[model samples]
Target: MNRTTPSTHPSSDKGHSVVAAPVTAHPLAELIAHEIRERGGWMGFERFMELALYAPGLGYYSGGRRVLGQRPQDGSDFVTAPELTPLFGEVLARQVLQALDATGTDEVWEFGAGTGALAEQLLGELGDRIQRYVIVDLSGSLRDRQHQRLLKAHPSLVHKVIWADSLPEAMSGVIVGNEVLDAMPVHLLSWDGARWQERGVALAPQGDTPHPTFAWADRPAPEGVRPPTEHPDSAYPPGTVTETHGQAEAFVATLAQRMVRGAAFFLDYGFPEAEYHLPQRHGGTLMCHHAHTADADPLAMVGDKDITAHVNFTGIALAGQEAGWEVLGYCSQGRFLTNCGLGEALARTGQASNAADIQSRVALQMLVAEHEMGELFKVIGFVKGPWFEAIGFAHGDRTHTL
Candidate 1:
């Protein structure tokens, strides 16, 4: 993936330099414009983001080019761990095994299973260890790719893997979400020196374009809208925009409630409360990805790119705790993978006969390398049943510190 530093600073993102959302002929744009007009000229950023990414057949995720791959040339906006290497899922499966044995459940429920890559690896490695594997994704457009991939990679286990449009009322197994929380719609909260505002979107004409263009609009934060982090923006300069993980936190809470006898684990790039709301990072963490290019402007992309925010681990942990799920552990991706046997996985590759053995080893480095996804991405686990130790968070746990 190609990374280029953006020209605009977070401090000015919503000011004179605020970027415009990419104008596109895509039907999703029309849909959004229609909603804005119907809503009397403004819609919450979270709702706008929901339609942009998961509006059935029109959103970027449900209808755009392949969303997961090595690079944009491969029809992907970005790369994910399972797409990077099979070794990732292989290593993660060991921890799943422990959860299954601990819970005595034979079902594995996976959310946002893009292209079913993780499912392919997990089914291959875990074999008959699982009875039923439920794959859930918001985009029905991706099920075709997932079906074909699983059919070719694991014909035998394909029968066990079923696609569900929604979660079951009850289930008993390990649940996993990798980079999934980041995709959930987030509310944009802005501090304007004196008070907070709920940032939103409105339609307006720009330049010579006859069609409507996306613009930022702000309103007083909804009643009872509490600060996302403890510190808030006590001393940060004005126009300090940030995101609140209400949707993501609600998702964890719902999953925890429905999960009767199993555990759930999520892996994403983020920080605990203190670091997440550092006074230094006055600019919020909202970001957009298009053809591997990173930008702070989500407005410009419309339905052509992926918009995401850093997962707030502290929020996730608190959500789980409120829902009565035990906070198993939290740690960087490097430490989690190491505790789950990434070091041994890499060593085994040294003696493998696969043609891509060396390539696989390199990919592993990118997954856990300190300078890469390692320190930034973290794993957080929660349990509902008799809590069995989460092998992935057995060591170097940073939960207390958070």
Candidate 2:
């Protein structure tokens, strides 16, 4: 990606230590500020977020693959499940293999293949069983890193890996996305105790503030101001801020259309429809990750960190269903992994004392623990053409919850 400009910021954000942001003003901020000026001095938060996180080479995700890792020393904002342990992918492979066997396809399409860690784990474990591994990414920035990783780590099977900037006319295989949907940009809606408005960002004058700022500004929700229909009762109190899942829902709608004969699975931390739109959650889920620290301010750093929002499984399920795809199942990561045979995998490791083995065990435990990724992270499966009882949902399918 040919980014607009470089970014420069301080090493700390709001008194908290973080990955040192550029000392000088980042070029991307200048470009975005100019963009805001051109757009009548205001840009919707969604558009701002999209540009900040996916603006070619300038976005947080479009530059490097090392941002996804398990340790703080990895120079990453946060660690995903795949970065935690090989067992994460191994157990997930069991679920994918079953889906492939059921659908009678040998291909695996992965979205947002971070660091190619999960890809390596899947390819290594699946072996000759998987004929092709297609990585579909919008940024295309990780191609070189993924290619080198595959070539060096699995020389013989490296030929099976391919990268695509766009989706094929139709797909017929197992599709997987881990911690992917949460990163999709979300629309922020605010209730000001009286009316609804859309929250957005506007550029601050060149010398108005430090760290090159984009201040929060609100306007009538574009077309006929109104809150989302997810909650028609208007039960939310004043001063409430919530998010609408248009991007995530739209992505699923498009995926359902392109996928002609296969099942897709997404793993992320989210909640069902009823729980998601709770009035108690006054603040929206918009968040930023920097050096393992979570923060709510996006104005401080332009392109120096990761920004994300929680997934609305309800919106995802509705999109898939509306597009005529079957909602196979939805369950916790722990239950899903257990149903997919995590115990068998752990037993095979045999209480090894080696560092690698010990790390794998710890990761496995974290993946299934009560208060860890186990309960918060969820797995949702969708199918288009052929269908069979997805084994991962056999234990406690929560299709009804969605």
Candidate 3:
């Protein structure tokens, strides 16, 4: 079970190099290729994700390359809001307050705390309001940095920030995950009218291969889930594609079970069930990020690239229900922030007495505007306790059948 980039030659017809550049060698790529070869040159989206995100030492998130949020250096790949400013956490603090009063829990756990900036701001805003703060991430390299950041942001709450590689036993707290679900591995399925199949990556023929290429593998459809819609006649011609994700479902299940008796919020970019199952989305939403460019070649950058799938909210909701957590609210990030007082907060900042204060107002507006990250991203939360009024669902404009 070994693999390597295959060779390709210049095309006589096109007079162009048929070969793409060699993929940078990474331990994760090697390992995944080995597994695929062992299992007949194919793997499910979930398996791909398991290897990509947590394959020992070579996976994307598990690797040492720091491509999280907002602190990327010159020409770096990407950054997130948590890196933008402490104010992001300040706003989140308002939401945490709602969760606290709703769930009757005093603790807050943050997943995938990239660089720990959000935790720092959240702890600062929380102050004594929260009994404890836990930062759960796999990167130990950022632990000391997180401690230092929190110490500076909220000296009083520094000791309250704890680090754990895994969830605590019998925990009851508000769990917040920002941009976490999108990174979860997703299984890509193809609906061929009469049958469904899984997508897989396979090493091309020795002479024809230019790095590894992906192909569809005929396999049993996921149990209990049927095609999005029936396609009679020649709609697919026996080889068309559609996508679904049991992997994301399993992830939601894991989180739901871990919550046991609390609230969990998932914030990421995705469409609801209605648009997600649209007929035009036949190519599927699997994407790869390498050096800031979004493309389909997972092998283009190997260990250095990021691969993600648009979260299926319907699947997540269904899994949550199955796992025993009650779904409380489902809405876009824009509506959720508005409900959490984003408008009022911005207006207050707009009344800034000085130049510096006015600048602060502008930044917050950037986060709330519809043109920015507002409409595209969605936020969903599940609760097991008394809190019930749906926060984001108050706005019905963007609401879907989910």
Candidate 4:
């Protein structure tokens, strides 16, 4: 396991910046290009996302680069909860403890333990009381690093740690995946004002070299689309483009099928079914991350960049119900935190710290406020059995909040 940051290999010089690092042919980039060519040069954005996120060894996550690398070029690409504050984990611990006690299990399984920050924080909060802690992720190097970090942070809890390649078979415990589902492959569907078509990527021949371009595939309008765009409301434009997620359904279905007699909590950015289908969001929510900047060009950097789509919470809830799990609760990140006593937590910390700790309070507010990641990100939980009495689900109208 290496802590060194993986290099982003630029695939083409066109549309690249002088500030952009020189092009290096990462194996994943070549494979993606070849795959596109083999597929007659036109593949859906979903296919592109599948390749970017899960394509064997060459994809963003599969290719050994930091998929959570959200920071910037000098460092990694991204910073999540564990990266921002330890309090995030403490609050999560409080929530997880509620779920664990309800489920009557002491197991904790985490997916994509980015930098092991969440794991370290949760373990620190749970202490020796937690019976088992497991991480299901691909980066073996990251798993080793996580092991070392956890051991150093809580040597007493080291014996309880477990690492696996996938979710345990019919395990009874609390499962936590933060900012995970957004990375799942998303099929981009657009209403051309006449018919529904899926956005596909293809190889565009540029002299001796090739570049990727967006093309359309004939498909039915996603289930959420409305035939007549007649909004008797404000802020919505007629003839606007809209996007809905089909991939999120598949992922949630998979989770629902596997999760039996336990609780599953997923935290990501998205809206409810009604809000998700609003006419204002016509441009679609598909975006790519290149050198920390958001770009629409999925083919710009190949495997070196991050491509993500917003999760559809409505779809997740529907899929979870279909998969035989009970939808325990749903809420915006703000309401979920508030229901989880975020305000009280902040007040308690405020009482403990001096003026210097003001920044921490501000940051906490940012996480749960209406304007920040609070509204954009949401928390949804599914329980297989009688795991009730949690803060977020029992009290808040997550639907109205959205």
Which parts of model 4 have CA positions greater than 4 angstroms off? Answer: 1-26, 67-73, 208-244, 351-359, 399-402
Worst 10 residues of 4 by lDDT: 9-18
- Taking the tens digit of each residue's C-alpha lDDT, what string does model 1 give over 123-185? 998999999999888776678889999999988789998888777787779998988998999
lDDT of 1 at 370: 74
Q: lDDT value for candidate 4?
A: 0.67
Between prediction 1 and prediction 4, the one with superior TM-score is 1
Per-model TM-score on C-alpha atoms: 0.94, 0.90, 0.83, 0.83
Over 4 Å off, model 1: 2-19, 223-226, 351-355
What value does the lDDT take at residue 258 in candidate 3?
A: 72
lDDT of 2: 0.78
What CA root-mean-square deviation does each model show from the true structure? 2.3, 5.9, 6.5, 6.3
Residue-wise C-alpha lDDT for candidate 2, range 1-402, written one tens digit per residue: 000011221111121122322333766787787788899988887888898888877788875535655556867677777777889898999889889888888899999887788899999988898889999776555667788888988999999998987888888889999888988888877776656777777755446345456666767666655544466536876656667878999999998988888899999888887787787766666777777777677665777777777778988999998987899999998999999999998887766889899888887888887677788788999988787899899998888888
For all candidates in order, the CA lDDT equals: 0.82, 0.78, 0.65, 0.67
User: What's the lDDT for residue 210 in model 2?
Assistant: 56
Which whole-number lDDT from 0 to 100 does residue 42 have in model 2? Answer: 81
